[model samples]
Target: MRGAAMSLSAAASGFVVFLLSVSVVQGQDDWGVTYTSTEICALKGSTVDISCTYRYPSRINDHITQVKEKFWFTRVSNNDYVDIRSDPEYSGRVQYIFGNNDCTLRITDLRESDSAEYKLRFITNQHNGKYTGSPGVTLSVTGMVTDLQVQVSRLLVYKSYNRAELKCHSSCRLPDHLHYVWYKNRQKMWRGTSSYSVSVYPADSYSCAVEGYEKFPSPPVYAPRVPSVSVSPSGEIVEGSSVTLTCSSDANPAANYTWYKENEVSPKASGQIFTITDFRPEHSGNYYCEAQNRRGRHNSTLHLIVVAGKFLHSATHILYQKS
Candidate 1:
């Protein structure tokens, strides 16, 4: 019945009808996945490994085990992903770093133009049938610049105070891991996490250094790197409550925030903040924000409490900071 569903009877002669039916049936046939690349893109001009593993459906793999073939499909822009072998432009730049249930790709010396979507694809035979694969990893490339930026927030500088703490943020980078350093007036300071703060610089110049695969001039004094962060409010305040999470971070490039909750990573989750425009006891959770800089991430142990569950917008900031 699986294959027979595509056959059009004499009762249906329209090509559009046949095509529509094929699409509907094929929609149910999907590839399986397990592991995925923790990070999709690396620093500008660096090596990136897009890894993915999969287990075919029991009906598709029966008891089969050995893999017999492998290949890849590169997404050009949108709507089409073709073999890299056929495109002269990507010929030498693309290489199969490794292939298997865990297929990976090595894209070297990435340039801005190299910035786009990529994947690892393949196929293998199993006892049940031909275990063709739709399994793969997504890859994105980013630019690497040593130049840094400086910023300060909620600073309480006292008069005659010998020092003030200021933060640095590096934005526009996509690397998953790298080393971050603090620099002041051309000298290296202590290396902390991505968020580096030096005792007040007396109205002087400061910068940072992020070393990875990006190489150019003797890495100039870059803008300071900021850590990925989000602000949340306390949840105890309401039914029909309002909230917002301010996400800010430092990296050689800007840090991107992807919100998550419970068991859902992306699609199943909703809202930047859990806005209980209408209060309900069901709106409670151990809520927290996952902040990530290009190099690492930090999670706050936070929870949203809906006491008596009343609704109001004034408590948004309090609820947001709760977690």
Candidate 2:
């Protein structure tokens, strides 16, 4: 009976030892930090968030404790890590979000100089219980090109013909190596340089953006093309008939229309449509409509001829009398 009791006691002792060994192995396996992503990209003047989760043994050397200190560092020297939040460059820009075992670092108003590798470190109340994540998160910051502007210039070629010159501009100056791209009505038209010149008509719409960053393009600026003019009562113009002249142009911010007669320096009418209550020979002359906006202006011309009804009847009567 004594031998059986000894065997039972030894078996119970070995079982306890085995359970302790399993618990140690599980604790070691769960006592490390992990990051969701090791690399991230952010736009300059924007914000970024780095996330991670960490763990530690609940009991170290038979003593229970809790986390005492947690911070993020960009560099370590001589077993000492420097906290990024304490740096002057990151002051007021760095924020920490801490949960049970998860942590997040948010940086706002990011600059190009802020790009670097960041590591998370934590210390527990237990003696000599500190850990730093093996690998850190690397951030790359890039600038966004904005405030694009378009400038237009007109040069007289010959007689009444004029040539247009267009140049794309941006408030933020980028590297000279970066090129400019031009878009016509949302379609890629030119790529290479900032300036593009062409004889423009009223149907052309233009926008511009940087070469690498095409998603954010400048608001379209229009080069007013020659306006299309239409006169009411399409056939022969008769005396004492109301006539309407309509002008239309394809332009950004819409085009302002002005009507003028040939050799007249002032506009005879305004708006997209011009009305004449009674048509007469005095109104018969070369007429033109101008389409204009802040970017540019263009004009189109048309001629009108009016005939009196009495003149046609008098000619017919004279022919009958001669016969």
Q: List the residue pairs that clash in candidate 2.
A: 201-225, 202-225, 202-226
Q: Against the hidden true structure, what lDDT does model 2 obtain? A: 0.66
Top model number, lDDT: 2
Which runs in model 1 stand beyond 4 Å of their true positions? 1-30, 58-67, 76-81, 97-100, 126-138, 144-159, 162-168, 171-197, 201-205, 209-323
lDDT of 1 by residue, 206-270 (tens): 55555442242122322223222233344335455455444343332233444544454553233
TM-score of structure candidate 1: 0.40
What are the Cα lDDT values of the candidates? 0.41, 0.66
* Number of backbone-clashing residue pairs for each candidate, in the order shown: 31, 3
